[model samples]
Target: MSDTPSPLSRSFTEELWGGIASIFEAILAHPFIRGLTDGTLPEEAFRFYVIQDALYLRDYARALALAAAKAPQEQAIAMFCHHAAGAIEVERQLHESFFRDFGLTEQQVRATPVAPTNLAYTSYLLRVAYAEPFHELVGAVLPCYWIYQEVGTRLATRGSPNPLYRRWIETYGGEEFGRVVREVLQLTDRIAEALTPAQRAAAARHFVTTSRYEWMFWEMGWRMERWPV
Candidate 1:
């Protein structure tokens, strides 16, 4: 209910983000994330992550596109549509580069079953975009952008010696990505100013749920997760 207020006031998104800081801390301290900084994670794990991310981004873009369709404002639609395109572009370039360099075959990536965690994560976001109120849908989607940028910034400063891992870190930590996140945040704050307390609380719940998924996403890679067929 309470936001991270300045001496004067608190924005709903700011409060919601601050409320989730502990969860964010847990993510920052996770061994999976730590590995990206230390260059100690296994190659299979990294490859699993990259491939899974490519799969995830395709659906993630769809969710953003859905959000654009439902946005109340033209600005929201434009921003979300641009982001939806950017998501796929990032997926194509980033994952393809890693796939080529790391010897990941298209068949291998296509045949790889989506991890349970990943399936659940994307399904939830899609559901939110389809069914949740505008404010709450925005909340569910924001964590993906916000968390990656935060994690990327932290990891970028002390990058792993591994070239592949460094590439991942640098992409998220880069200024262009940061600019996108900032734009989203500004949009979030503007929408939030008009939201009711109950709506804000609901949005906060969506934000927290997605933030947890972000943590699980890293762990999903660390485990090199697969269905036990």
Candidate 2:
């Protein structure tokens, strides 16, 4: 873990702006997401993915809520809880609309085994939330917020033909999500500034590992691969 700020964080806000810009560009350039935007994804498979996303969000909310109780500051924890509440709202809407459209039931989603990527991501988060310092946990969780906003914003720009895609994109790309990410990053930077060299290195390793697992989760979902140890 490097104690120094990431090249991207040396200028903090400017780096975040540039980072998000690059991220959105990359997402829009993704072939699968492009296919999704153009309504070329197989209907059944797309539906399956949507169902999975909704289920994942539910679990994500639970994980965040659990972390919130242990966050260092009352305001920070409260914000996390509020974010979880917002996620539940989106989950409900996705359930009522997209799930029904796809003929997916809550029971079916509940019965689905955690994909390897999903397990890796979730387990890492839970471990950070439970055992790491509050600042480190924030660093660990920031990727989730960043990734979704990145994907959602790019997907929105592509103007998906499916109403559901549009809804999902807008929900995440909107001002609310932006605000959350901004707040989290602000808190993370404050903590990062205070870390000892050894602690900073550890925190960076945790963040990078968590990010790699996030990518792994998507790969597993898309490839339908079994967990690979």
Candidate 3:
């Protein structure tokens, strides 16, 4: 790990951190997440949601691998890719189990229309992977890493009887997942610190924008609704 704080961390004002924390809190407190904890969601439907998410991760992992090749922070990017691959494995297991339980397959997941939030988030990632500055790419991806850790850890504490919830929570709440979150946070913080004030402001905007979309992603999944008209 780099001993130096990430630019984002160094530049982070109390206000900025508080704003980001607020977004995270909103996402966790979203009704969908609450429903998930209480087991009000139908298992098959929830499993379907997981299937779509797993497919998204599959593409996300590939995008990261490609981005790693051109990353200015080559060493850090490589490490991120390794960590991302591990996340992919977790998703794959979830996908397989969902398939077994719901009699759905990867092909069906591919054929399904993506939720609006799913499309928005994935598009942002691909665009960042292809066009954004190396540090900015890390900034864009950090929320996904951080939010999963936060949500997963919280759900794990809730002790749901649902086996799937147990599995999902265990995967994301584990040490390996925690390590990934730390790595992304450190990378984004480094990016923030290196920026000038104007750049830092821009970075903060990007981070918050992406985070808002993340909340929408979960909301869309939770509601299983198409994007708002």
Candidate 4:
């Protein structure tokens, strides 16, 4: 009898997501997300979130590129590149609209420093992208796509009275976004199929850690967090 560990007895997507349920619950329970979903989130708080998201996307685009460079398959390379560019372009368009509404100048947006949680989250993804195995890095990047898609879908279904909040929800929870999430999940599952039990465990750690960061990111925005110094 061959002992190859039976391909995890489940998909890595299920395992990783199952392992993070409490964290995901915490994220879903976070007031920031709730308020945004219901159209009650403070405008300033949402503004802070959008600005930080814009900054986060800049580095996130690079991280995705790094993942693309490390991809073992031609398909993965194309997928990552497409998502990377799409991520950047979507954020640029969203930010442009928000900037016009908020009277934010390009200079001002450029001058804004990355929030602590944003830096930590994006930096962790970058480090993983650069330093980990191709499959592991792919695991690392999955949550960013997965979590936002989840959040977007939930909020979108609830239907916000606030146009701004609804717009944010639509971008994430829309059919187009769902398609992107499905593509990433499929790719992650393909990569996970080859990982050993130990490797799967490691990948789970990355997933959970990043999931926590998603929680922290919303909390950071809610608090309008700044450097203590």
> Which runs in model 1 stand beyond 4 Å of their true positions?
1-8
lDDT per residue, candidate 3, 114-169, as tens digits? 77778777887888778866656665666677778878889878856677767777
Per-residue CA lDDT of model 1 for 28-118, tens digit only, reads 9988899888988888898888889888998899999998998999999999999999998865798989999988787888888899999
Compared with the true structure, model 1 gives a TM-score of 0.94
TM-score per prediction, in order, is: 0.94, 0.79, 0.84, 0.94
Worst 10 residues of 3 by lDDT: 7-16
Candidate 2 lDDT at 4 equals: 82
- Assess the local accuracy of residue 156 in candidate 1 as a C-alpha lDDT between 0 and 100: 89
**Clashes, model 4:** 0
Give candidate 4 regions above 4 Å deviation. 1-8
Q: Which stretches of candidate 3 lie over 4 Å from their true place?
A: 1-16, 227-229
Q: Give the C-alpha miss distance for residue 208 in model 3, angstroms.
A: 1.1
Runs in model 2 deviating more than 4 A are: 1-29, 226-229
Cα-based lDDT at residue 151, candidate 4: 88
lDDT of 4 by residue, 1-229 (tens): 9867664577779888889899888988999999986777899998898899889988889989988999999999999999899878976898879888889987898799999999999999989988898877877788889999998988877978888888888988999989999999998888877878899888888888888898999999999999989
Candidate 3, residue 127: how far the Cα is off, in Å: 1.8
lDDT of 4 at 154: 82
Error of 2 at 194 (Å): 2.4
Candidate 3, RMSD to the unseen true structure: 4.8
Clashing pairs in 2: 1-201, 117-217
The local distance difference test score of model 4 is: 0.88
Q: Give the Cα RMSD of candidate 1.
A: 2.8
Worst 10 residues of 1 by lDDT: 4-13
